[model samples]
Target: MRTEGDTWDIVSSVGMTALFVAAIRAAETKQPDALVHDEFAALFVAAAGDPDTNRLIDDPELWADSPLGLGFMGLRSKFFDDHFRAATEAGVRQAVILAAGLDARAYRLDWPQGMVVYEIDQPKVLEFKGQVLADAHATPTADRREVAVDLRDNWPAALIEEGFDPARPTVWSAEGLLPYLPGAAQDALFARIDQLSAPGSSLATDTFGSDVDFQQLADFQTEQMRDTSFGKIDIADLLYTDDRSDPAEWLTKQGWTTKAAPPEELAARYDRPLTEVLEPYAQMFNGMKYLTAVKPS
Candidate 1:
């Protein structure tokens, strides 16, 4: 279990999750009908220096047991890609990516001129990402700033110190982040985001459902992880299965207009319906709703 002061780079624990997602994105990018293309994803995975993780990136059969999980990662990536793009197009010039892992959005996405992308995460994680991207000679599409701090700390203060313009309309995203935080911490995160948001600011997040059997799902995830090349590192250990409030409902109560959609709806919209093997996993995965909300102007 990760403690309050526990720190990780891009190759272990919570950091590994980032590399895992990047591997999946790398795989999805090679697909003919890819929903999103993250060109730098594979580079980050290769730089992780873990043989098993690198094997997972190179071998298709390594993820064969979790087809739905793979597909959902692709879908989730595209969903957030669109969400950030929409926010930028809507004139929100400042964007914050909470718990920004190895996400290369600041480097890969086309940002509006003069836009600023603030990446908030642990210092080491940000350092590793910067080094790898720098080694690859990659440059950000926006004026990118790295706010190196843990979520449980005074991150808003750190963000502000890094020149974050909270008074200006900002777009904030907490992708693949909620489950790692305890119930109380999740609530506190949104409260902090709400406190910083200006009128016309928006927030997007993906969270697990309150109704799902988390124990059963965690067990299944453990089994699947063990069966793959990346099996030695149990992804389940990084998750905090404590009961958390519904994000969409909570956002609405906070006076924001919100919309929530399951992976099935998003899959259908993208014309990539789930297969039979993917059905049960889809049900479990669908429990995670992709939510987007706008604060009243």
Candidate 2:
């Protein structure tokens, strides 16, 4: 059964954070040519029903010129674009997106031939998303698979039973899922992935945003959660057991050779022009470090 906390997790997470990714993609597509799949953003929003899931979706003015928001989104897009590209180039035919929510990459991105993408999330979430996509008549570009299961459950066993290949290199992305899981659960989750993944497997995920002083977001979100009938669930309470100084450092303990990159460097690599100097607040939070780790082959 899905708890109110779980549902609120979906509510608070959608728009405020996505503003960055969506806007960057929106701006990029306006160019004569762009990188990766520009259309993925629209399909993702249509499938997710931005307003239906995210409370702030109706208020467009909240993030006018939001550098912090865009920075975060830009980071995510660049990370995913790099990881997925590497997965295909490395001959990885299997990919898994945990707590897939309303992500539309399965329908938008051009996956390598024979690649199968499995998305795992709740039944209702997946059901609503499939219905929305069907209504939109959106066509998927990859060999798409949807597995409706709570991340805390025996999803690894279920996935293996469903024919997930342990021998082949798999591209695994955790994205926004970690914030919703308890710390112990997060540990177990990584352990399961490690057990299931073979050498040469790559993992990419966003760590906690520095700005989330989580207490403030918790106080404000608590009131909003209660008002929405989602209850007074503290996000910080339900997830994140190990807060690390370096996400890459922690992964190294798991036998992954890791590299951490700050946002400023990433912008340069993507050829995005640097405008104003970054605000201390924005650079500290949301403008987090991203880490990529690979299991030894």
Task: Report RMSD (Å) for each prediction in the order shown.
Answer: 1.8, 5.1
Tens-digit lDDT string for candidate 1 (146-197): 9999898789999999898878999999999998887888888999999999
Indicate the TM-score of model 2.
0.75
| Model 2 clashing residue pairs (backbone) | 181-239, 183-241, 211-285
Taking all chains together, the TM-score of candidate 1 against the true structure is: 0.94
Summarize candidate 2's per-residue lDDT along 1-297 as a digit string, tens digits.
224436422334332233324434544444443544455455545444444323322332343334422444545666776887798898888999887765677777778789888888777667766776787788877788888777878898778777788888888988766666765677777888788889889888876553456555555545544432223345445545345334566668889887767666777787765456433334334556666789988
Error of model 1, residue 253, in angstroms: 0.9
